[model samples]
Target chain A: SQQGEEDPQALSIQEGENATMNCSYKTSINNLQWYRQNSGRGLVHLILIRSNEREKHSGRLRVTLDTSKKSSSLLITASRAADTASYFCATDPFTDKLIFGTGTRLQVFP
Target chain B: EAGVAQSPRYKIIEKRQSVAFWCNPISGHATLYWYQQILGQGPKLLIQFQNNGVVDDSQLPKDRFSAERLKGVDSTLKIQPAKLEDSAVYLCASSLDIGAVAGANVLTFGAGSRLTVL
Candidate 1:
């Protein structure tokens, strides 16, 4: 079973616009990480937020985690055509393995 | 400084036939993982290894799938008598260490091997 589920399974936005995706998890987690995958490619790590952290930013990407609600969101600001990809939220429990969500597909039209 | 490496970027085989994929993690990485990703879904952990020792394989189909990471460097995943549902992408990833608190073993994944069981 998947530990996390991302909302807005598919999204489309023009370049330079902002795109947001939400994820809800069922279990407690030590950390939540967002990853991106170009179609037919392996995943690329985006950012990881620990349970103690609320928000973090990397370049044009911002991620927020609310442990109390067991939810998280990934926002890509000033999106570019290169940002077009499927985004996934992965939760790591107290153990080693990471359980992934269904993912959200974001399309950035140029 | 190289990234994870995987061979046979793509393969097509008939059902009931056996197939195998290989992976070589980034130099010096101590943790390795294998994941299965069916189209339209996220990747699922099939097995994890911490330097030649099995860490977790609870989700693996032990009856047909087998993996090994000897000497803690490279690894291989094999499926005997493949089934139609076995068609998917197999991803291999690695991290510097499983216990590095600062890093927490953030993974670096390979391009993956796409398999098709006809």
Candidate 2:
């Protein structure tokens, strides 16, 4: 079963703008990770944050985790048309298995 | 290293028919996973394999869906009597031993099998 839920089912923005996606999960988690999927393609690993970590950054992506609230957010700075895709948040609930959320679809127009 | 590989990029069959999907994980990877993704929804794990043994099959529909990893290298997922609701993309993924290490659980996904059940 899916454990995470993402807010803002869809988002539209212009290239060079910033985009943010949020995810919320029920129950405690061992860690949280984000993934991206292009149209008709498999998912790609974006980043992961352990339960003890609060914030992490990679390239133009920033992920913040608040275990107290069982929530996490992904920020994409300077978005691009190429960045247009669906983003998903997955949770590892100590079972060593990742359960994904509904996902957020981001559309960036050039 | 080569990434995970899946067969039959797409398939179309009527309800009650049978279909099978194959997956070959990256060389030496000890973990394999299968997920089902309906349109506009996130991928849901159907089963997971650690080596040639089953780790989790709680979400799998055992009545119609089954999977196996014989040599701990390649795996197959089969639906004996497909249902219309089973029309979705079946994704295969692989990763290192998840429990053996904390940072080795990042998954590498395959291109996925697009199954259309009419």
Name the candidate that leads on DockQ: 2
The TM-scores that each candidate's chain B achieves against the reference are 0.97, 0.96
Q: In every candidate, how many clashes are there?
A: 0, 0
Residue pairs clashing, model 1: none
Candidate 2 residue-wise lDDT at A87 = 99
Q: Could you estimate the TM-score for every candidate?
A: 0.98, 0.98
Give the DockQ-based CAPRI class for model 1.
medium
Quote the lDDT for B20 in model 1: 97
Q: Given candidate 2, what's the lDDT at residue A47?
A: 97
Q: Given the true complex, what DockQ would model 1 score?
A: 0.69
What DockQ do the predictions score, one after another?
A: 0.69, 0.78
Model 1 spans with C-alpha error above 4 angstroms: none
Candidate 1, residue A84: how far the Cα is off, in Å: 0.4
User: What lDDT would each prediction earn against the true structure?
Assistant: 0.93, 0.95
What 10-residue stretch in candidate 1 chain B is worst by lDDT?
B98-107
